[model samples]
Target: MKIAIAGGTGLVGRALTALLHEQGHEVITLTRGKPKNARHVQWLNGTLPLEQLEGIEAFVNLAGVSLNDGRWTAEQKEAIYHSRMTATEEMLRIVTQLSTPPQVIVNASAVGIYPISTTATYSETSTQRAQDFLGKTVADWEQKASRAKELGIRTCLARFGVILDTEAGALPLIALPYKLFVGGTIGSGKQWLSWIHVHDVARAILHAIETPSLEGAINFAAPQAERMKSFGKTVGRVLNRPHWLPVPSFALQLALGEKSVLVLGGQHVVPDKLMATGFTFQFPTLDEALHDLYKS
Candidate 1:
């Protein structure tokens, strides 16, 4: 299968590209510049002008602004929205022009799409749009992916929570305090966090591609969900450090500004849909995932 990955320069995109390539699939990277080879194409203005994706079998849209980059100003918020929406909108237009449109379109969404008010586990069927910035952003993101279904393309939205890797995503940020031996919980440490190993995340994506039954939003998270405070204990145990201190929500808000919600307030999301579909997770427990990541 030939897969074209937008935002192929980022962490998740790079990992997915490697996974697909290892399976002997031809992977094409669509970036900001012009195309230089068959495996790489440039998409300026967040869209391709020609029907370059003529015979592509799958399209993965991972192009979006960093969710934890910094405080969201007026401009940053717009960039975040434009990046995801514009990329999906463009993919729709280009697909309609294709000689044979791609069979599947796998897009990136977030668990933040679920409103933060509820402490309940959120699956694909959960409703009620979140009112916050990140929540609203994900709602729009999924809507964009849902559009691909209109053209008879099998569209799947991989709604991710925190993805664990050595230097990518949230691992570095979460490990910082632990490295300093000041690791602790955020707020009451009761916020539900759904996370997955980098390897599992990549594999699940491939699963989505191969599974003929996959459609609509699919949560790419670990089956077991834990409180933020307990997660601190696992990290501390893995690093053989103390986990006594606690970072209050007010302190987090002060430090991270509006982005603190990502750290202090999180959903207790579950990959119920993924598990029910007969997909087994490699690292179900947080300890197993943390030890593997820290040991390596």
Candidate 2:
């Protein structure tokens, strides 16, 4: 299979790219700038050379900036929203123009689309929308990605949670405080933390591509969701450190501004749709995930 990936240079993209290559699939990356290598092609202002998308069997769109990278100023928020919307819209445009459109289009989304709650668990069927900036952004993101379905393509919206890995995503930063022996719960500690191992993230995307019936929003999260306090303790145990100190919400809000919700806010999400299709998680529990990530 030939797979074309947009934003194939980011954290999740890199992992997905490597996984596809291991499976003997030819991969081409669509970038915002000039082709960095033989594998990359440039996409300017949502326009691309149509020939590049021809005969592509699968399209995995993970194009977006890190929501946690910096404080979300007015300018930063616009960039975050535009980056996802434009990239996805561009992919749809290219696919419609292709002589042979891909069978599956797996788009990157977030569990943050659901409203934040301490006890409420959310599934794909949930009707209420998140009332914040990130939530609205994801809502629009999914809407744009869903447009591919109108072209008779099986589209899968992967609503990923906190992806845990030793090299990148949220794990390293969350583990750093534990490694230094100052780690503890963030905020009130009861907030839920829905997470998945990076290994499963790649597998889930492949599963969506192979399974024709799998479409719409699929939660790419573990079956077991943990509270912030418990999650902190588990990380501490894995790192052989003490979970004693607490990072105040005020401090985080002051430092991260509106972006503090990425940590202080919480969501209890599950991979019901993914599991319904018999997709098994590599790290179903926090203990299993943390141990695998921190093992020396």
Candidate 3:
């Protein structure tokens, strides 16, 4: 199989790219910068070398700015929105122009599209879309990515949860406080944290590509969703540290502005669509995922 990946340098993209290559698939990275290696192709301002579009079977667009980079100012929010929309639009445009466009298009989305709720459990079929900034961004992003279906291509929107990897994402920051023996829950510690191991994230993407029946919104999350308080205890247990300090809601809000919701708020997202299509998760439990990631 031949795959083209946008934003292959990101946290999730990097892992996905490596996994694809390990599985004997040819991986081509589409980047805005210079092609650093033979497998990399440069695409700028929605422009790409048309010759490279041939024979690509799968197109995965993970191109987007880091949401947790900093506080979500108006400028940063626009950048976040622009980066995702433009990169996805470029890939879709190239796909349309290709003589043999990819059979499947797997896009990166977020569970944040579901409203932040403790009591509500969301699945792919849920019609309730979030009206907040992050929710709207993900909803619009998925809408744009959905255009590939019009061209007779199978499209899968992998709505990611809190990706748990030791190298990057939220794990390190969450574990750092534990290492220092000051780790605890944030806010009321009751908010649901829909999380998945990074390995499962990569696997889920490949599953979506090969599974013909999967052609819509799929939550790439674990089977079990944990509350912040229990999540903290698991981290502490895994690292042999103490979970005994609470970071107040106001503190996070003051520090992260609106972006604090990414941590302070969460959703109980279930992978109903993914599981229905017969995709199994490598790390379905928070304890199993944390132990695997933190094990020496």
Error of 3 at 52 (Å): 1.8
Give a tens-digit lDDT track for model 2, residues 164-276.
Answer: 88887777888888888889888999999999998889999999999988999999999999999999998888788999999999998998899889889989998998999
User: How accurate locally is residue 252 in candidate 1, as Cα lDDT from 0 to 100?
Assistant: 82
Winner by TM-score: 3
Report the poorest 10 consecutive residues by lDDT, candidate 3. Answer: 44-53
lDDT of 1 by residue, 259-288 (tens): 778877788787876788788888888899
TM-score for each candidate, following the candidate numbering: 0.95, 0.97, 0.98
Return whichever of 2 and 3 wins on TM-score. Answer: 3
Deviating ranges (above 4 Å) for candidate 1: 34-37, 46-52
Q: Which run of 10 residues does model 2 get worst, by summed lDDT?
A: 44-53
Error of 2 at 180 (Å): 1.7
Question: Which residue ranges in model 2 land beyond 4 Å of their true spot?
Answer: 45-47
So what's the TM-score on candidate 2?
A: 0.97
Model 1 CA lDDT for position 99: 83
Q: Residue 202 CA error for candidate 1 (Å)?
A: 1.1
- Candidate 3 per-residue lDDT, tens place, 1-296, comes to 99999999988888999899899999989888888988999996556666876899999999999897877999999999999998888988899888899999999999999999989999889989889999999999999999999999999999999999888888898899999999998889999999999989999999999998998899999999999999999999999998899999999899889998988899999899888888888887898888888773
